[model samples]
Each structure stands twice: as structure tokens, then as C-alpha cells.
Target: MQIQDLLKRTDKLPNVPDVVRELIQLLNDPNAKYSDIAARVSHDQTISLKVLRIVNSAYFGLARKISSIDEATVLLGMDRLKTLVIASGFASSVTKVDGIDLPEFWTESFRVAELSQWFAKRTESVDADEAFTIGIVHNIGRLLLHLTAPDVAHDIQTRVSNRQASRFKAEQDLLGFTSQDAGKALMDMWHFPKALGFAVQQHKRPFADGDPDPLACVLNLACYLNACIRTEREIDLVREGLPMAVIEAAGLSPSIVYELDDAMAVSDGLGHLIH
Candidate 1:
């Protein structure tokens, strides 16, 4: 089916729960006061508990434990707090998708998100938090595909495994569209920033021509590198699409890309925070 058809099907798609959606809107609003956000978060006892648990986890490496949501907000800072809230909230919703194993997907997704944030910080392309958030949400399309068309998603996974084809190509061949297409459509339906939607859409094809957004290029490279390491599949087709201009724009090098694998090894401790 075409992406437009998928867009029309979004009403049937799973969404962030109402409370979580309101929290996201509040967090995204520039003029939102902390007291209002805190109150909203407080209203959801389960979510608040998860957020506190994550904050106190090894990821933050806090000198002392954070015992309350208010303390977490104070310690994590607004940017990190918002990221944790969004990540935790989304994780709860997305983990429930049937026919897909959540643990494996979470491992790869969290690794990509961590790596993307590291690259963004190293290259100074954007705030590390913003890059991390983008990295976490970038593949949300794949989750949607699994929800809407599990059979097609299985076919795509098989093609990716057996043929070593790029995820984008596998999805296109099997379903007449790609995760990026579906992801962009979902982002649009949710009224996400156009830049973020574009990043998700074009992440697999960074140098597709036009005014290239540097942030998208960063995420594109991060996703490419993550897939290269995690999947046994050879990805020459995916590699060839990485443009020299885009790499230059991000101020990254082959050496840096090679080092990312080792850097990720050190980040294993941070994975516990996402639980």
C-alpha cells in the first residue's frame, strides 16, 4: 500500500496514551511551567514511578538516589527530564506491539539512540538530547508497520536477513513503501516538527538531493553505522548511499565511525536506565 493509504489508517494505529500525549504536549511547549508539568506527571502514578526508576538507574550515575519525581526533575534538568519522560512513556506503549520481540528491538533502538547522541555531541551538530530523542523515535515507523501489517514486516525482515538488503529496500519490495515513509506519515499525523518528520523520512537516504538538513545527516549516519554493527547482513547498497558531502557537513571521518563500536561497548551500563 502507498504511504497515503497508511496515513489514512493512522486513526486505527496505536498512539501514545491520552495522559502521555498531554505530557508530551506540555513538555514540548516552550511556555509550559514546571509546576504544571510536574502536576500532570504526578497525576499518573505508574508513569511517575517508571520515570523515577529510570532516573535513579545507572544511566544517570547519580551521586545519590533520586527518590521522587520532583527530585528527578530537579536533577535531570529539563532537557534530559523531557527525554526520559518521552522515552519511558513511548517504551511502555510500543513494547506491547504483538508479533515483534520487544527486547531485541529495544536493544538496537537504545544503542542507536545513544550512538546518535554521542555523534551529535562529538560533531556539535545539535544538542545531544535532541539528537538522542530523534534517534529513539526515528524507527517508530517500523513499529507501526509491524502493528499494521505483521506479515509484510516479517517478509521485510526475511529479505533483510537472507539478501542483506537495506531495511528501506526490503520494506519497499515487500509492502510498496518503507518504514521511513510510514514513520514520516505518523509524525505528520502527530504534528511533530517538520524537521523531525523529514529526518525520519530521509534518514536512510541522507544525500537524496535538495537542501540537506545537517541534523538528519547526523541521524542517517548513526542509523547506518548502528545497522552495520548489529546486523550480520552486508550492506554495500546502504554504504554507497552515504555521500561524501553529507559526511563532510557533519565533520565525521571513517576513523570516528570505526571508533563508535567501541564507544558503544562502554555504554552498556546506560541501557539499564531505559528499563
Candidate 2:
């Protein structure tokens, strides 16, 4: 029931693509140029093609097609396009799990990621792309469980539904780890920058240490808002679930969150993911 037990279950982890690993390093480097990242992205034809497709597609709503990685870099900026590359490349690398619906999972991830970026930019609390990355990867542990421990994962989902148990509590009670634990272990395995890994670990209790990790807090709110959006709930329901520290950290009021309704919609963008 320890993290070690979960880690020992090899099927639970996503294979972080070489493309994603290199991009993470470049993003962490203060001196890394846009050209450098562009070059790295172009090294993987699948990712490069996927990014170009998304950029040129209606999702980005550009005036003209993005013909190459260089052009994509210029139009989308380094961070935003890089976030897309990472999301697409990582999605490409993960094999289909027996039970989880990857398309829905990815759609939700991207939705939350985009919302996180918008909110982060609003507050200037963290980099938009960093927030985006954290949001997309936050629930990765759920995938890990679906792959490596299907029965337990399904049972937890059932309990969360039938018994009104929360996902975290159900996971903790049945398997001795929450999705947060699995997320932390997965991100740690991928060797991302600390804040990205930390967000995965601390997002469920973003100010548990009495100080907010701005990105985690933003992601915390993003996940809540995503659920609200998916369920067609009112903004008040979302506000009720949000932590006060997260609201302060993101410089967001309930009114502002309410105002963000349109920007957070994902039905159009989910169509752009590579098949």
C-alpha cells in the first residue's frame, strides 16, 4: 500500500517521451532560445506535425497556416506552442489503458490547462504555460491506476459514485494512495522541474505548508472549475469548493470566475487533438 508498492507496479507509469524530456530541460533554462526549443520540437516528426496541425486548425484561428516549426514558434510564441507539443507528444506516448477513456481524459486535461493559463495570466501569479502544463498533467495518477490496478481503480470510482465518497478518500482507503500520490510519483519519474512535480503533489492541498505554490493553487482552482463546467453547474457551486488561499493566490474573485465561462469551454478545441 506504500508508494513503493505502487511504483513497483510498472504498468502504472507513462513513458515520458524523449521529446517531452528535452523540452522540459529547455523550458527550465533561462538562456534557452525560442529557436532552440523550435529545433528540438522539429526533431520529432510526429510532434512537429501534430503541433502544426493544431496551430493551423481552427483551434488557434490563425490567418494563415503554420507551415513549419519555425513558423509555429513565431506565431504561437515559445511557451504556448511548447505546451501544445508537450501535451500532444506525451499523449502520443501513452498506450491505451484497458478502462479509462483517453479521449475524454485528454479533452478534460486540455480544457483545464487552457483555463489555468488564462487565470494565471489574469493574476500574474505564475507563467501561463507553466500553469497549463501543471493542469494537463495533474490527474495523471488516475491513468496510472487505471493501467496498473484496474480493479481497485474501478472499485474506487464505483464507491465515489454509489457511496458519495470523494475520489481521494476512496483511493486512500482502498489502495493506500490518492491520485495525488500517483501524480507525484509519475511526475517525479519524468524528472520535470520542481514546481511541476510539486503541483502534482500539493495541488489537492495547495497551501498545506502555509504558503501557496502559485501554479498549484491555480491548478487546484482549474480542476474545480473544470468539473463545474462539465456538470453544467452554476458558478456559485464552483466557488463553494474553492479554497480561500487559492482565490487569493490567483487574484480571482467569484465574479471573475463567472466571467470566464466562455473562455473555459472545450468542445471546439478537443476536436483538434491528433488521431
Candidate 3:
């Protein structure tokens, strides 16, 4: 089925919270005050609790507890606060899909989000916080498919698992579009910046054309490094496994991946948010 058809199943597709939708709009507004953002987040009790829980968790290494959205905004800065609120909102919104391990999925997603932020900051290629937000939501398409068409999604995943086809190829052959396409559609539906939708759509082939989105390049590299990190690949293997073209496209030196690898080793605590 087409993405629009899947999206039309509003009863199946999870809805992003209203507050998160509003916060996303604030991301593009330069004049949005931190106080205003904090107040907006406070509007959702569930999201606010999750956001504060994540901020005060060991992942952030905060010395003092943040009891309120206002305190979190003041302590974490607007970008950091925005990232937490967005992450919390998205995570809390989605329901469990059959055949997918929700905890593991979220763990990897958060890992990628952190790694993407690191790459963005290290290479100065994109807005680091925006990179983080994109990373968190990048896999929404996979979840959406499972939610809307479980049998087809499972078949496609099985094909990839059995080495019959790559995930992207299986998705395109079976669904007529890749998860990236669905993700882009979802981003557009949610009114995210067009650039973010482009990044989601082209993350797998960020350099497929003459011009590549820097955010896509950052996300693509982060996914590679996330795989390496998860598999406990040595730094040498990680370096050798990276696509040199992607490295160059992201304007990252070969050595930077080493530093990133080290950083990810300690970021396992981020799972605390989802756990």
C-alpha cells in the first residue's frame, strides 16, 4: 500500500501529541522564548514528567534534580530542553507494535540520536540539536509500517534477516517505497521543516546526487557508527567499515570516528530514558 493509504488509517497510526506538534513549530522560530517553550511543555503532564525524568537521569549527569519544566529549561538551555521534550513526546506517544522489540528499538534510536548530535557538532555540518531530533524520529516509518501493515512489514524484515535482500531493497520491492519515504511523509504530516523531511527521505543515500543534505550525511554516518558500536567492533574495523564517500560528504576526518566511538561507549545510560 502507498504511504498515504497507510497514513489514512488514523486508527492505526500513532498520533504525535499536540504539545509536541506545537514545540516542533517553535523549533523554526528564532524569537521563541525559553519561558514560552517551558510553559508549553508544561501543558502535557505525561510529556513533562518524561522530559524531566530524562533530564535528571544519569544520562545527563545532572548534579541537582530538575523538578519542573521551568527548571529544566533554565538548566539545560533551550536546545537541550527542546530535544528532551521532543524525544519524550515521541517515545511516549507510540504504542508497541507486534514483532518489534520496543525497548531495544528505542535504545538504538536514542543511541543514534546521540551519535548524530556528536557528528553534527564535530563536523559543524548541521544543527546538532536538530540532528538529534531527526535521529530520534528517523525510524518512525518502520514503526508506522508495523502498526499499519504488520504482515507485510514482517515479511520485509524477514527477507532482510534471511539475507534474501537488503532492508531498503526489500522495502522498495514489497512496499513500493522505502521506510525513508514513509518517514518523510510522516515528517511532512507533522509539519516539520522541509529540510528535516528531506534528510529523513535521503539519509540512506545522502550522497546519491550532486548535492547532499548535511543533516542526512550526519545521520547516515551515525547509523554506520551505531552498528559498529553495537556489535563491539574494534576501532580499526569501524574505521575500515565506514564508507569513505560518506566520511568525505560529512566533512569528517577519519580520526573523528574514533572519538565518537569512545563517546558512545559511555552513552549506554541513555537507555534509562526509555527503560
Candidate 4:
């Protein structure tokens, strides 16, 4: 299929609920007021219940229980709670990934989200909340492909595992586009921020256009480290850490990535917003 066709294939993608769409709109708004957001979320019972559940989940380890959106707002902060609401609200829409283990897929995605935010905080080059939200939703294209073309998607993943080659190449060979291409289309369909669309489109080649986007660079390095945590050997990780290009592009020290080898070795459910 051509890029135009992929961009227009809106009906083939997962159905994002209206609540999630509203949350996305709120998150993308720069001048959005906290009371407006709190009121919007309060009207949606599903989101309100899920938000309370996720915040109270042992993952956050809060000092006191949050019983209302107002309380959650004061405790988690508007920016942090906004991203959390997005994560929790948007998760149910993308759970049906073809040929991928659902639990393991979420586990890895959550790890990448945490690591992306962690890297962003350490670098201070981008908004950590945005990075976290981007990391979690970055691979919606893969889920789109799985839902749209199951057999072809499985074939590409098989080649990725067996040949240890880039999934991007495999996707291009078989489907005329990679997940990033699909991701861009999905981001556009969702009316997300332009930064998210740009990052998703070029995260793998963050420096392709001269100066790199700090957000994309962090996402690239975080995805790389997350993959290594899942698949590569520990000794190999210590001996050959993040490439110089990644460190320079993200303006982070090599030692930070190296030291993370032992620290972030396990996922341990650090990023699971939806249980």
C-alpha cells in the first residue's frame, strides 16, 4: 500500500474511546486550566474510576488515598496526573495485538515508558511527562498493523527475531511502510501534538535532520536500552553501552546508560498503569 493509502486507512485502526480523545485534547492544550480538566474527568465515570484505581495502585505508593479528582489533582500535580489519565484511559483500546503476548507486550511498553521519562528527567532537555506519554503510545502503529494485517505482521516479527535484523527493514520489505509510518498516521488521526507525530516518525534517526529533537533522542535511547534489557546479555551491555551518537544527541553521559545496566535490568511492573 502507498503512504497515502496508509494515512487514509482510518477504519482499520483501533477505536479510541471518546474519553481518551478528550484527554488527548486536554493534554495537547498549552493553556488548558486545571479546573476545566478536573471537571471533564469528573463527568466520565469510567475514567474517574480507572484514574482513582491506577493512582491508588501500589505502583504509585501514595502517602494518602485519593478519593476525588480534586484530591488527585493536588497530589499528583496537573501535568503528572494528565499523563497518567492518558495512559490509563488509552490502554483498553490497544490491547488486541495480533501474535504478540499481551501481558509481555504491556510489560515491555511500560518499562520503555518509565525509562523514557527517567532519561528525560536526567537530561532535562524535554518535558518528562510528554516523554513518558510518548514512550507508552509510540508503538501503536505495530498494534495497528497487527490488527490490520495479522499474518504479515507476524512474518515481520519472525524475521526480526530470527535474523536479528531491524524490524523497520522487514516492515518496508513486506508492507511498503514501517510501524513509524503507521504511527505518524495514527498520531495525525488522533489529533495529537505535532511534536509527538514528529518524534514517532523519526525516533530511530533522531539526528537525521542535523540537530536532533531531544524528545526523539531520549525515546530512541530508551527504546534501545529497553530492548537490551529484554534481549541482550548483561556483560555485553557493560562492555558496549549506548553508542556515542545517542549520548551526544540526547546530551546525556555514557556513564548514565552504563550504570543503568544493572539498575533497570528487570521490568518489575514499574510502568504498568492498567494492571
What are the TM-scores, per candidate, against the unseen true structure? 0.81, 0.89, 0.94, 0.87
Better of 2 and 4 by TM-score: 2
The predicted structure with the larger TM-score, 1 or 2, is: 2
Superior candidate under lDDT, 1 versus 3: 3
Candidate 3 has what TM-score? 0.94
lDDT of 2 by residue, 106-199 (tens): 8788778877887887776687778877877888888878877888888998998897698878988998778888878877777788778888
Candidate 3 has an lDDT of 0.83
RMSD (CA, angstroms), candidate 1? 4.0
Best by TM-score: 3
- Give per-residue CA lDDT, model 4, range 118-222, as digits (tens): 888878677777788788778877877877778888889899999966898898898888888788888887788878878888898887787888888988878
Please list all clashing residue pairs in model 4, or write none if there are none. none
User: Model 4 compared with the native: what TM-score?
Assistant: 0.87
The residue-by-residue lDDT of candidate 3 on 123-201, one tens digit each, is 8768877888888888988998999999999999899999999999999999999989998998898788898889989
Model 1 poorest 10 in a row by lDDT: 261-270
Best by lDDT: 3
Where model 4 places Cα greater than 4 Å from the true spot, the runs are: 3-11, 25-30, 235-239, 254-273
Steric collisions counted per model: 0, 0, 0, 0
Model 3 worst lDDT window (10 residues): 263-272
